[model samples]
Target: MYEQKTKETDQSVMEFIEDIENIKKREDAYKLVDIFTETTGYPAKMWGPSIIGFGAYHYKYASGHEGDAPLVGFSPRKAKISLYFATGETERDKLLQDLGKHTSGKGCVYINKVADINVEVLKQLIDQSVTFLKETYPSE
Candidate 1:
């Protein structure tokens, strides 16, 4: 009966962006919204308190853990902007090489600013994440 803490919320995405203290991060958040929306053909939705997500899919692992998560998303945190994408795709590493200044974790890509990364590569990551998630976990 474990519940997910980061489930989608009804919060307003703009209101969340507007609350960002950093003017540059706020602006970058807006730009990311536009890019993710255009690439995924899905409206931005507030995931949890901070994540702005596009589209969603439900996933159940072999261990029986299951949850619904955004196909593509990002968060403008105090340290850096974190981009969320599928973790297992090999092509992700290939694209990240072409993506300008960024560090990556197991499933999150961190960039100081939008200008620090190539926007086209960001779009490709978004599309690839959405495609991978949809194909991996098609809804019944």
Candidate 2:
């Protein structure tokens, strides 16, 4: 049996953002709060300790691993802000191509700050991720 580490918490998203040691990172986190909230039409929730997540979906794999996860989220980390989005969407790669100066992992886009990317493209990425997840894993 396996337990997931990143479950949603009753913790405060604002407190977490305010606790960010770097002023710029904290400010960027606030900006992201607005963007994600506006894009998803869902209020932000604290996921685990650091991730500010918007809208959630439940998922179960073929192997029976199952959990609820945010449709989109972001963490203002020490090194760079991590933007979480769906990894396998067909339009993801094309959108990332125009997302400005950022590097991406399999499931996260790393940006030094919000100013480094085109906000419109970022919104498009958020929209695509949410749409993909909803269609792929509709609520029960």
Candidate 3:
């Protein structure tokens, strides 16, 4: 049997943000909290030790691997801020075209700071991710 390490926890999101050593990153984290919360209509939650997530959904794969994950989330890492969004959403790549300066991985968009990207596009990404997840894995 396997278990998920990134399960939601009771850790305080504020404390985590405040503890960020980089002043700019800490400030950006706060702004992101507000942006994600307003965009998703969900409060910020600590996912694992570092990720600040909003909302959640249960997902099961064809291989029987299933777990609950945040609809969208982000982490302020030492190198860059990693934005997490739903994978396999076509609109995501389209929107990223107008998202300003950012590098994206398979599931994360990396930004040096909040000012480096378009906030509106970020909001759209958050909304699209949430909507996609809800549709892909409807609650039972």
- Candidate 2, residues 27-58, lDDT tens digits: the string is 99999999999999999999888888999999
Q: What is the lDDT of candidate 1?
A: 0.94
- In model 3, the runs with Cα more than 4 Å from the true position are none
Clash totals in order: 0, 0, 0
Residue pairs clashing, model 1: none
* Candidate 3 local lDDT, 22-130, one digit each (tens): 9999999999999999999999999999999999999999999999999999999999999999988989999999999999999999999999899999999999999
Any runs in candidate 2 off by more than 4 Å, and if so which?
none
- List, residue by residue over 12-111, the lDDT tens digit for candidate 1: 9999999999999999999999999999999999999999999999999999999999999999999999999999887999999999999999999999
RMSD, one per candidate, in order: 0.6, 0.6, 0.5
Task: Note the Cα lDDT for every prediction shown.
Answer: 0.94, 0.94, 0.96
Ordered list by TM-score, greatest first: 3, 1, 2
Q: lDDT: which candidate is best?
A: 3
Candidate 1 backbone clash number: 0
